[model samples]
Target: MTGKPKLYYFDGRGKMESIRWLFAAAGIEFEEEFLETREQYEKLLQDGDLLFQQVPMVEIDGMKMVQSRAILSYIAGKHNLYGKDLKERALIDMYVEGTTDLMTLIIMYPFSSAEDKEKKRAVIIQKATNRYFPVYEKILKDHGQDFLVGNQFSWADVHLLEAILMVEEKKSDVLSEFPHLQAFKARISNIPTVKTFLEPGSQRKPVPDDKYVKTVKRVLQMSF
Candidate 1:
């Protein structure tokens, strides 16, 4: 067996960051190979390494996987982060879809120049905080627990933390109105496996940076 899973992606965290944090929260060891240039990624895609011809792929037990959410659900199932039963699974799935709704906007910010990205970012920031985040806040508040599904921590909470960080980066005041969400983020971050991913010097980023400057235009339409 592979000692650990192998993940391939652009250097920027992008979709892979949440997967990384999931692995950490699950206490799994994995290795990563980052794309240094667009040419490297294209060559891998052309070679048929990526099934959908996109990145944030993982190799587990010699079988390759694509789509970040699929990988996450797989890992959560294997690692017990998924929750205790079918009822919790239903709720987890609902929140995962919600997080994806917020994530789609965050991932689109880098497809253009700085000015256009900011314009879209501002609009997204407003909608995410005002409209979407409150839904999560109420879920947390209604549950009256440290997590989204059941009384135990679930992958839904981990995924929400990822979305929260992205919104917080754009506007530091993103969580100002959502105390339950703020507390939810704190619980996710307090996990030993998750803490490293959020700590200073970690590769986690709210948006693509200098390393991904050449890579964004290609991944802009990514559904993963």
Candidate 2:
């Protein structure tokens, strides 16, 4: 909390991307140490930096944090993005959990085989438009608020916007059927902090390409 939070992960948008989005939404600047080779990841393991032998470890407030959810909850709570009370926090958690589910699908898409990519893409788009987006759409509509939980900009909004963009990367017109989500995307994208992150030079990573996939697989010793 004194200096910027330093993030450890591969150079692409994996589990760490949501952490980046939360920091951006909270208007906090952070640094990232991208793991491009197996040695780099193994060094973290050797140093006991990774709690569960994973990346997405963050150095913040004198603690080395791993586990995406734990890191996200801390950032959100510290930055007042979690919620006002337990009830509100519960709602935020519900919305964010759903968004995380959708994001998991998109995150793994690039790792699929060539033949499976199309099938994966279809599933992603289908879930986004039908299962996921509709839920947020209804939430925004029923609440008649600018955000998903309590009508305030919180972690759920940040995660939802991030998930929306990820889905759109697979299908440009993915939000066409979800009018409220379209508006939500526009609204959240323009927040001063988020806007800066969306600009060309910010730390926001792009959708994973072949090189990103290969590097992650190599560094993590993953087959898929």
Candidate 3:
């Protein structure tokens, strides 16, 4: 990858947001082609760029990469963010997988009906506080490490930080009860590269609003 990697996705944060987070963590600059219209998305499909017919296709290392996990793994490996050994990588994978489950809920929250939005919000908070946050809190407490695995920064930390912020967007006080996680969030957010990404005018996307929802639905030809 001589030049910056180019990412293909919508203007909002879908599955591609984590990819952006990983790139930021790696201190790698990239370009983006936001698919704002049905024609644009159809053109990508017509060109056969999307092997899985998905928008998160990334152009990196002389290849067009599809599938969010595969793209993330490649970037992580290239940047030495995966792990030192197979055991450490396994631990990172486990942590990343857990965070992915939490992220999936947040990603789909915008698509809920007006009536179901409140209910869904409550569900997300419940899972974050009770199911997810506690697990990470314990991991940090037991390991006494700044990161989730091998006492070093890895893909798991990047994904977890992203997940924490996304949950916080839903509920401001979501992390008040988890002291370890609160510290971890503060530490990760202050990483020079991540701090820059958090600033305004950066590539970080805001929460999905009506326009974002409408654009994504139209581009993907979704009914609900």
Give a tens-digit lDDT track for model 1, residues 27-119. 788888877666777787888988988778899977789988789999999989887988888889988988888888877676556668778
Residue 192 shift from truth in candidate 2, angstroms? 0.8
Q: lDDT score of model 1?
A: 0.80
Using lDDT as the measure, which candidate wins?
3
Strongest candidate by TM-score: 3
Displacement of the residue 63 alpha carbon in candidate 2, Å: 0.4
Task: List ranges where model 2 is wrong by over 4 Å.
Answer: none
Clashes of each: 0, 0, 0
Task: Please identify which of the two predictions, 1 or 3, would achieve the higher TM-score against the true structure.
Answer: 3
| Worst 10 contiguous positions by lDDT, candidate 3 | 1-10
Query: Could you give me the TM-score of model 3 versus the true structure?
Result: 0.98
Regarding lDDT, does 1 or 2 come out ahead? Answer: 2
Clashing residue pairs, backbone N/CA/C < 3 A, model 1: none
- As for TM-score, the candidate ahead, 1 or 2, is 2
lDDT of 2 by residue, 1-224 (tens): 45989998988899999999899889998888889989999899999999889878999999999999999999999999988999999999999999999999989888899999899999999888889899999989998889888778899999999998888888899988889989999999999999999999898998789999999989989975
- Stretches of model 3 off by over 4 angstroms after superposition: none
The best-first sequence of candidates by lDDT reads 3, 2, 1
The TM-score values for the models, in the order shown, are 0.88, 0.97, 0.98
